[model samples]
Target chain A: MARDTRERLLDAGLALFAGNGLAGTTVSDLEARAGLRAGSGSFYRHFTSKEALFEAVVRQELDRFRTSIGDTTIGESTVADVKIALALEFHEALTTLGQLGQLEAIIHRDAHAMGDLFDEVEGLYNAALDASAARLNQLMESGQLPRRDPQALAVTIRSTLIGYHLNTQSFRRSARRVPPADLIAILIDLISSK
Target chain B: MARDTRERLLDAGLALFAGNGLAGTTVSDLEARAGLRAGSGSFYRHFTSKEALFEAVVRQELDRFRTSIGDTTIGESTVADVKIALALEFHEALTTLGQLGQLEAIIHRDAHAMGDLFDEVEGLYNAALDASAARLNQLMESGQLPRRDPQALAVTIRSTLIGYHLNTQSFRRSARRVPPADLIAILIDLISSK
Candidate 1:
């Protein structure tokens, strides 16, 4: 019950913060949004202040993001199986970032002011890219994949996934856009070193 | 002198709107930011209200964006030159978008509620994309580019550009990251059919 209340408070805080800048949202606003008593009474029981709540939300979202990328396992045994595994992994990771609309809102509000929180988020992003590159390098070394340029291919995959997610979600344009699988197919073709 | 003042008002609004939500920012705030006397007097001489000023800013920014992508001429000559030219054009368009930190803020606030203004902005983005695709199709038709999948490549370029611009600029993690020229070289290699 205690954990549920805490989660409820964090959810309210994220929605309020994302839509209204931190300065625009108030304690009482969060209280009401959380369906708790108005004013900071019940809110204070859970959080020290709105800023504290904001920090909690950041931590919670980061955990959620980490959970979303549960695994980055590249291959099991076969070469062809390795290729399929990578595409699936890439698609899943991209989906999480693409769907992280609310967290994205928080990041855009000059998140650098939040110090370590922003650092963690950005670090996670870079780690994702590095992991992808490492996986490609491993496959190349094993003679499974041949992009003739594994390093370059790794960056392109990461960039296209990021680009596709942000554009489709942000613009809300292109209702009939290219499916992710089709894009993965193209990436695989480009990965070949014919 | 009048046009200069108008431009000043638009500039002020763009910066303010991008950083602060439309509701958070006031006319007086814009006036002060523009170095004009506060309280909307000089502002009135330019825009009727803050909303009107926002519209003018959108128009000005769109014009600037279009200008950034001044020309997309392929070539009457060789495939390599044409490839280089297209890559250069794509890079410029992406640099503009990636560097649009301020404009991005306003977009996230769902400024579409402001109506035609947001439509115009979104439309400009779609048009830029359509133009790129058309340019690619033209090249493929003329046999200058022998890709088995020109359409896929066109979309990939646009998506990767959008993704790369958004990621690097947002994270600011990799100050010395993949240069656009390097990405372009990778792209040219991908365009090869053999």
Candidate 2:
């Protein structure tokens, strides 16, 4: 029941933090929401503090996310294929993240207050970006991708994917949901045509 | 002097809100930082509540941002030129907002708590996107641009510029700043090359 308790704690903590933010949520509140007895020694047995629990949750979610995307498989077959692969990789990464709303809430909450936390989140994002940039550079060097600033391209592709992700994901309004794959194709076309 | 006092109050509130979130800041904090007497009726005369003052600051900042960008003047001389112009406009808009960290803070804080406020902010962003999309449609119709999904390109361009803006502006410790114009050029090339 220990792992179950920790999982429940993470679930409860994520929901509370997303809804009330870090400063607003308390350890007691988390304990109550987790279906654990109040003043139980079980809470401290798993994690030292709420922040530690938060980091655990974030790491778990990110790990799941990276696994979901799998390793980005690129093809040198055509410029179109390369662009599509990049878009697909970026889209999958964002799609996995957007569904949970965990990282979004954390990034938007206490981002200014929690320096190390934000840096960790930002590092994950930038690392993904750096990978894409390096890939772009390799493609350009091989003459598949045209001569373009790989860093800027990496940033552009990422920003495009994130902006798209933010607009569409988790929106509860009555509207058409553009399929993420469709967006990837559109983005690739835009890149390929240019 | 009254107007000057109100301006000072707005200035102080912006600084406080940016440094500490809305919940963390107090009315007394605003008054003290503004150099006004604590618990003075003057605060009530200018604004109904701290939230109202925050709204005013947000609106003023958005308006100032709009004015700073001026009208989107597009010289329909060439496809590349128009794309560049639109990219420049988007970059400038995001740069102005990101520099002050006003909208970013407001969006992060009270985002879940204040639905109407977040909607207003989202509206401003979407409206800007809609305008850009409309312009792209017009250009495409006149054969100035290409026959692509104006909507997708609009979203893509806007998203890319915003993503770039979020990454660079006000990131305290930085080795090199990618001039926003450079980003715009890179984005425009990506589109134009395709």
Candidate 3:
């Protein structure tokens, strides 16, 4: 029961912080939402401070983020296959993190101030870039892709993916959908052209 | 003199807000940084509220954005002319906006709050698309370029440009700079191919 309570607190806190932002949420709100007594001081039992709790949540997510990249093997996939896997990974992360809004909020909140936090975020981005770069390099080595700077090409692909995420958030709320397969196909066509 | 004070306040506010974000700044910080008396209520004299002031500063920059597009006549130029103009515009906007980081911040902060804001941003994006489409349309009509879905082709081209901006921010921080002329040459080669 104690273990369950602690996990519940962490879960509740992540959801709130991701949605309402760091400064906008409080312990009482977490406690109530987690079904703990308002005066029980249970939050203290799990987290000494809100910042500490946030750090825990970030660490948990970062660990998962690292493992996620480790789990994917893009080198073996077709271009379309790689893109679909990546898009699915992003979608899963957003769903698991409670809200897509939370990912943005966390990036905005922690990217500058937290050293480990920023490192983790940059690490995730670079890992994806490296994966994409490797594939491009492979294609080039095999006389598939054109002879261009693989690093530059990889960076361009990654940047477009990030920008798509940044730009799509507004349209996302209206429940409109992007055909990721179509989008990826278009990207692959552009990249593979002569 | 009043106009000078307003300009000073706007400049200080832009630096502070761009560095720290909206919540991290205060009115006193604005006044002190602006070289006015601390807590002198001078900000209120120029602007009614902090949010209002921020909006005005953003608006001022956005007007400059509009002019930047106008000053570069890629939309009405020859194919070669348009390509050269676009390369310059991209280089300038990428360098300036990447350093400030405010344009993206403003879009992230406010793009989702209202449908109109979303539309406004889309307009900014689509204006580029429209410009590209018009040029392509002109080329097709003149038998200089092949006829195709100009709008879709424009979006693809704009998406690629967007991707370039996105990549420069992340991984191309140290690559050899591509001369605008060279970039124009590469793109012109691509378009002239089909």
Candidate 4:
């Protein structure tokens, strides 16, 4: 029962934060958005403050992201399989959390001020790169890809995807738009080449 | 003389915006930072609000970017010259402006809102891509690069640079950084291949 209330509070906080922004949002906003009355009394019963509640939401999101990292079956999957899987969901995860955009915005804002939060953001990116690199290393070792430094190549591919996500924010005007399959195909070609 | 005041205001706005962010900053901050007390009181004499001032600042920075496009001697320069002279400076101008830790936070905030600001952002990116494409077209016409749509290739290169910028914010743990020269070299090689 206690755990469920905490989860509900987080969901409510995410919605409020999304609508109002971190700095723009207030304790009353969270309390009202949660649809729970009893003033600050009930709210404080569950979480210490709005900032604490916001921090919990970030932790929950990071934990969810960490869980997804475990899903990358690098040893079992082919390069093409991994690439396709990544493209399908990567940008969405970065930009949105269901209906709430607060998660991305909150982290992007405070990551500058808070060292620990910044570390978590960095860790998430590195984990993804490491997973991708592991797959590339396997491909090279198996003679599927040309001999390449999997780490460096992984960085390149990872950077390419990061670039792709950023460009997705501005794809409408660019003359060349590479669809997900084509992007993956290009990567496969680049990796498999000598 | 009037034109020079506008220019000085823009120069001051960029430095202040880069340090304090768009929302956190105020006209007083701008005036104090610019060392123009009465002249700064005179700031509103020209622009109505801080928003208007920001729009002016954004325009000035963007114009500086567009000037680099004008500097590209597309028809006269070789592929190597474009990479060394035009492309590298273009990359620098982008990094110098967008890579500021505070400015990106402001951009990230606005971008999350999914508003008309996106169009303005896209226009600047596309302008850069167009400039690069014109140069690439010249190279292809001269039989230096494979004859393909230079616009398409230019978009790809712009996307690659966008990705690097995103990584600077999104990935904090990858101490394995690639210098802009090596990265630009890799991108040039990718697009110029026959």
The candidate that achieves the highest lDDT relative to the unseen native structure = 1
Where does candidate 1 stray beyond 4 Å? A1-3, A19-29, A37-42, A74-79, A147-152, A173-176, B1-3, B23-29, B37-48, B66-71, B74-80, B98-101, B148-151, B173-176
Instruction: Point out the higher-scoring one by TM-score: 3 or 4.
Output: 3
Provide the TM-score of the second chain in candidate 2.
0.75
Candidate ranking (DockQ, best to worst): 1, 2, 4, 3
Model 2 lDDT per residue over A147-179, tens place: 777887776777666656655532333113345
Ranking by lDDT: 1, 2, 3, 4
| Candidate numbers sorted by TM-score from highest down | 1, 2, 3, 4
Residue A118 lDDT, candidate 1, scale 0-100: 85
Clashing pairs in 1: A163-B163
**lDDT by residue (tens digit), candidate 3, B100-189:** 456555555443323344565556656755776786787789776655556655544544454455444433342234333343344444
Give one digit per residue, the lDDT tens place, for model 4 in B1-194.
34566667676677765544555467777776655674347777657877777777665555555565466454354446544654564466456546343344445544444356556656665676666678768767867666655655555455556566656555443325665655655555544444
Instruction: Supply DockQ values for each candidate.
Output: 0.47, 0.39, 0.25, 0.34
Residue A161, candidate 4: C-alpha displacement in angstroms: 1.3
Q: How much does each candidate deviate from the true structure in C-alpha RMSD?
A: 3.5, 4.4, 5.0, 5.4
2 or 3, which is superior by TM-score?
Answer: 2
Candidate 3: which stretches are off by over 4 Å? A1-45, A78-105, A170-179, B1-3, B37-41, B79-86, B92-101, B110-119, B137-149, B156-194
What is candidate 1's lDDT per residue for A63-124, written digit by digit as tens?
Answer: 87776655544333354666576777667766676657678777776475467888788777
lDDT of 1: 0.70
Tens digits of lDDT, candidate 2, B18-96: 5566766778889888887777766877789998888777777777656653554542334466775666565666656
Q: What is the lDDT of residue A73 in candidate 1?
A: 47
lDDT of 4 by residue, A38-138 (tens): 35567787898777887787787777767756654534644465445444434433333332234554554455544486677676767776766776687
The positional error of residue A118 in candidate 3, measured at the CA in angstroms, is 1.4
Deviation of model 3 at B135, angstroms: 2.8
Candidate 2: CAPRI quality band: acceptable
